[model samples]
Structure formats: structure tokens, C-alpha cells
Target chain A: MNAQFKKGVLDLCVLAQLAKGDKYGYELTETISQEMTVATGTLYLLLRRLNEEGYFETYLVETPGGPARKYYRLTPKGLAYTQSLKDEWITFIDQVNRLIR
Target chain B: MNAQFKKGVLDLCVLAQLAKGDKYGYELTETISQEMTVATGTLYLLLRRLNEEGYFETYLVETPGGPARKYYRLTPKGLAYTQSLKDEWITFIDQVNRLIR
Candidate 1:
């Protein structure tokens, strides 16, 4: 994968994952790394940026099995943003599919 | 479309377009804007970044039909980079497709 491409999509991918449920930084990094490669530092940086952008809000939450985790959840703005991304992706892929065929 | 998604995809999209042939800044912006919205200033900034990264090399070429234009084409590194991006995109979309179904 292109590092630049990965850099670009990491934020949105993180958002998509968080939209399903609140997740702590490490857990989010672990999940995304399973599907695509990303560094822990990079993930943290992106998370901070998204939080700063108001796409997400985070707070400390205690887990039954472990230490308190900094859980992250999407803001209303994030959900709306994800929907728009989904639409654009569908359109872009449709065009690419045609070209490939 | 998601501005963030657009931000992510724009570089790949621009590279893909240039892979077809060399083009100037304005033409690339106009072409992409037909399918996706992007500001001219953003396009130039991205172009500078890509050029700085050595993904592309640019030179001014005089056109018989008009003024000299700054044409951009992929370097060998850029082509390799684009190939990597394509592979990642395919894998990512395949997963997304399965989830959609």
C-alpha cells in the first residue's frame, strides 16, 4: 500500500471503526492493524486531530477486565461526515469499476 | 462527499489522471471537479507536496494552441507508488463489498 494513501485514509477508517462503538486508542489501533498497516504513533496523532476537529469526543471509562480506557465515540458531526464519505466512495468506485471493465 | 475522504482520495485520483497523460494544474483540477469537488488552491498545494515527494516531476512546455503550461508526469517512483495504492484500494474495497453484502 502507498504510505501516502494510508496516511490520507487512516483518519476516515478510524472514524468508521469508532462509529460502531466507543473504543480506546490501543484497541482501535489493534483492530485497524489487522486489516491494514498503521503505526501506533500515527493512529494516536490522527485520533488527536479528529478529536480536535470535533468529529469525536473522548472520556475515561473503566472496563470490567482491565484499567480505565480512554474511550472515543463519534460526535453528530462525525456521523454526518462518515455518510458523506460513504456516498463519495460509492460514486468513485463505480466509476473505477467501469474503467476496469 | 466527505471532505476528509476527498482529501484522502484526491492524491490517488490525481495520480491516476496523470498516469493517462501529463497535464497542468488547472486542467487536473477542472477534470477532478467534474466528478469530485476540490478547491484550486488545495490542488496546487497537493501538487507541490507530490512533486516534493518525487512522485512527480514537472516542467514548463509551450503549447502551440496556447501559453506555456506546467506539465506534470509520474516519475518511476510515482508509478510504483500508484501501483501500491491501487493494490491497497482493491483489497480495501473487496472487504467493504463483502460487508455491504
Candidate 2:
């Protein structure tokens, strides 16, 4: 796969996943990596970018079974952004589908 | 749409379009902008980035009816990169589709 293209959408996918609930970096990375092969380093870099962009806010939260994890949660802006991305992706894919067909 | 997300995919889309044939910056921007709203500045920046990355090479081509235009053509590396992107996108979308369904 094109690592760069995968890397490009990684941020949006991470934001979309966090829209459901707060998740720590490792958990998020694991979840996405399960669906698509992604390196921990790439995921971490994207998480940092999202945090820096103010799309996500992070805090240390203790888990019952383990040490405190840095949980990432989406802000209102992030949710809105995700919705827009979904819409655009649908439209873009629809067009591409027609062209290919 | 999420401007940043749109911005992220714009580069790939531009490269894909150029895979069909060589096109000048304005023509490429116009072609993509027909399907997706993109600013001229943004398209130029992407073109410049692709050129800098050596994925594309540009040269001036004269048309019978108009002034010479700068045409952008993809290198072999660019085609291979585009193929990789397409494969990754297919896999990623398939996963997302299954999840949504």
C-alpha cells in the first residue's frame, strides 16, 4: 500500500474512531492497525498532529486493570470535521465508482 | 467538507488524474475542481510539492491555438505510487464498508 496515502487518511480515521469515545494511543493504534496495517510511529505522529490541531484533547486516565493511559477525546470541532469528511468521501467515491464502471 | 481532509486527498487525486496524461497546472486544477472544490493556490502548492518530490516532471508545450503551457507528466515512480494508493484505498474502504453495514 501507499504509505503516504494511508498516512494521509490516518488522522481522519483516528478522529472518527475517537468520536465514539475516548481511547488511549495504543488502543487506538491497535484498533486501526487491525483494520489497516499502520505503524505505531505513524499513528503516534498523527495523534500528535491531531492534538496540535486542537481536534483532540488528551488526559491521563487510570484504568482498573493497568496504569494510567493518555486518553484522546474528540472536541466538537472534530466531530463536525469528521461529518464533513464523510460527506466528501461519499461524493468523491461515488464519482470514482461511476468513472470506473 | 473537512478542508484538511480534502487537502490531504487532493494530492493523490491530482496524481491519479495526471496518470491519464500530461496537464498544465490550471487544467489540472480545473478538472479536479469540477468534482471537488479546490482553491487555485492549493492546487499550485500540491503541484509544486509533487514536482519537488520528483513524482512528476514538467516542461513547456506549445499548442497550435494558444500560448505554450507548462505540462506536468508523471514519472514511473508516480504510477507505482498511484497503484499502491489505489490498493490501500480499496482495502481501507472495504473494511469501513463492512463496519458500517
In terms of lDDT, the best-performing candidate is 1
Error of 1 at B75 (Å): 5.2
lDDT of 1 by residue, A1-101 (tens): 22233235555577778778888999987887666556799888888988898998889988899788898989999989876666655676765543322
Q: List candidate 2 segments past 4 Å from native.
A: A1-26, A37-64, A68-85, A95-101, B1-8, B63-67, B95-101
**Residue B30 CA displacement from its true place in model 2, Å:** 0.7
Alpha-carbon shift of residue B43 in model 2 (angstroms):
2.2
lDDT of each: 0.73, 0.71
The residue pairs in collision within model 1 are none
- Cα lDDT tens digits for candidate 2, B1-101: 22232225566677778888888998987777666566799888888987898899889988899788899999999888776665655665676543322
Model 2: per-residue Cα lDDT over A18-93, one tens digit each:
8778889999877876666667887788888778888888899888997889988888888887777666556666
**DockQ-based class of model 2:** incorrect
